[model samples]
Target: MDLSALKQLGMDDREINLYLALFQLGPSSIRDIASHTGINRGTTYESLKQMAARGLISYAPKGKRRVFRAEDPDKLLLLAEEKKSALEGTIDSLKTNIIPGLHHLKPDFSAGNVRFYEGDDGIETVLKDILATVGQQTDKEYCVFSTKSIRHHLYRPFPNYTLQRIRRKIKVRVIAVGDGGEDAEYSERKWLKTDGPVDASYIAIYPPKVAMISMASENYPVATVLEAPEVARSQQVVFDALWGFL
Candidate 1:
């Protein structure tokens, strides 16, 4: 079976192997488990001690040898619950303590708050960040300056992004740089008149964050996310002014 999931629950590779070996060998001594798994005796001993500390295993001195036994397999559920509780605590701390401190530090590429990503994967990260930052809220909406070439970049890594957005019931107000993009529900699409060939660029305004992306360089897709309310508001105003013209 895949023990990677168990590893995520905080067990290491040797620990997983030893745990499984203990399960098979029943009440086993360090020597028995080491021989069964081909792990070094010292490492096996240390792992067993760690497992015991985690309450995953137990041992008792029988005559001169200390034999170890795995705890009930059902303890896996307890481990998962504990991890969930710890994660929830961490999330609370992040919202209440960490993020506010980081906000004061700096935000945006030019301002030390901006993160730059290059290549198609980097651009994909920018799009995915939007979805991850916005949780499930029916009225959640975002504004975007969409372009034709954006589709060429996004369709490869995130072919289902639009569909996922629709499913999440997130609304979007888009100003297409050229006469392009299709209409979708819960979205407002307007075209900006252009006389010459438009360079591939997209600016998405989502709350205290604004993401600017350019795909004009073909495979050299780049994006920057700025987390400043004033910047976002200014961009929103510009979008609205352009929006009014369309």
Candidate 2:
């Protein structure tokens, strides 16, 4: 198993090592912990102090010495919960405050950062970015102009992508250029009139990013993500206008 996940809960390498040392040794002194982990005394003492501040480790009096020990390992779950709560707050702030203020700044034409992805992995990357972004918003929906070319390539590599989207409560409004997307929960589709199948391109217009996938090439599937607030807003406006007509 990856021990690096402990870093996500805000513990550094030395801190994690110190905690493990204390846990294994069962209420060790700072000196014992330093000795066990091979970390120096000064560094170990500082780490224990920081960990105690975070409630990851605690101390008690044992005779004339102070004993330090790890809290229940399950306390890591509290870190996860705190992280989730903090992320939700940040997302809410972006949606409500930060993003709206961004419009007043002059549009940087150079801000359109285009990223290209190759093969099935590229398609997966684009889809996951869309899912993560749309999942954060209160609106929780994005607009897609999908075609057979993109669908045929993506469904194989990311068959569970749709189920994952639903689990995240991310919704999509799609304009199927061909035929046959029936009603599904958290999704709405409309068929748009097109001649000769619209050349097999898929467009997903989400806030601050617009993703396009193509399967027209013989060798591999390809995708591009364009991140520009103004560009995405323009695409969204067009999608909304067309959606109204449909």
Candidate 3:
């Protein structure tokens, strides 16, 4: 009854309409189908031809005219299964063909590479990707700037990740706006607080990547990630200098 699912099976709107029409009307001529479904004769005939070839419908001649009927409804399940199997086989072939070639593909920033993520999911993805780039450091230091009221938002993501960094003896360096130095109390991570308008346009340096997040001002709260070594190194040097002087 839900014909929408058939869309994934590559059935177009006209095909779905015709199939549903046939299911409801039983065996019928193209003219009858066209009249019943409010489709024109030419499109109805063309759609029926493809449906017959896909084994979704059948046509039988009654004298000089042909009547079209829906195939067994159970075959819909079979068609779905066939589509799944085909996709799985294609995926396996693609994996065998593509992944090995991926090793040769290097990040080329000169060719221009950047991602824009919007909404909460986009923000979360930027955070997760930054975390993944952290290497085996003697200390995992993070310099973050956030808009007002920092709570577990700062503390929770670090423990499990910090455990990995800490196994390598990596410590964290956090510098947030006023009173944020206290929020990271749950972990061994150190914090330094400064006074600023912690509302929007906060920049973060998490090694190899610099992320800037501006949350829903006049413009949408989208994230931009730049993955160039020169940019990252400059940010790193600036952060280290700020951490030392502040």
Ranking by TM-score: 1, 3, 2
Candidate 3 per-residue C-alpha lDDT over 141-184 given as tens digits, one digit per residue, 9 for 90 to 100? 55665544433343233335445545544344565545534333
Error of 2 at 97 (Å): 13
TM-score of each: 0.84, 0.59, 0.62
User: After aligning candidate 2 to the native by TM-score, how far in Å is the CA of 99 from where it should be?
Assistant: 12
* Clash number for each model: 4, 0, 7
- Write candidate 1's Cα lDDT for 156-211 as tens digits: 77778888878877889998877779889878998877788777888899867899
- Backbone clash pairs for candidate 3 read 139-170, 139-171, 140-171, 147-198, 147-199, 148-198, 216-221
In lDDT terms, how accurate is model 1? 0.84
lDDT score for candidate 3 against the true structure = 0.70
Which of the predicted structures, 2 or 3, would earn the higher lDDT when compared with the native? Answer: 2
Tens digit of lDDT per residue, candidate 2, span 1-246? 456899998888888888778768998887888888899989988989999999898999999988998999889999889999999999999988898888556465553478988887777778889888898899999999987555666656778888998898888899988875556678999888767756778888997898888774854878888888788999999999988999
Off by over 4 Å in 3: 89-107, 114-177, 181-189, 195-201, 205-208, 214-223, 229-246
Better of 1 and 2 by TM-score: 1
Which runs in model 1 stand beyond 4 Å of their true positions? 105-110, 134-139, 149-151
Candidate 1 has a TM-score of: 0.84
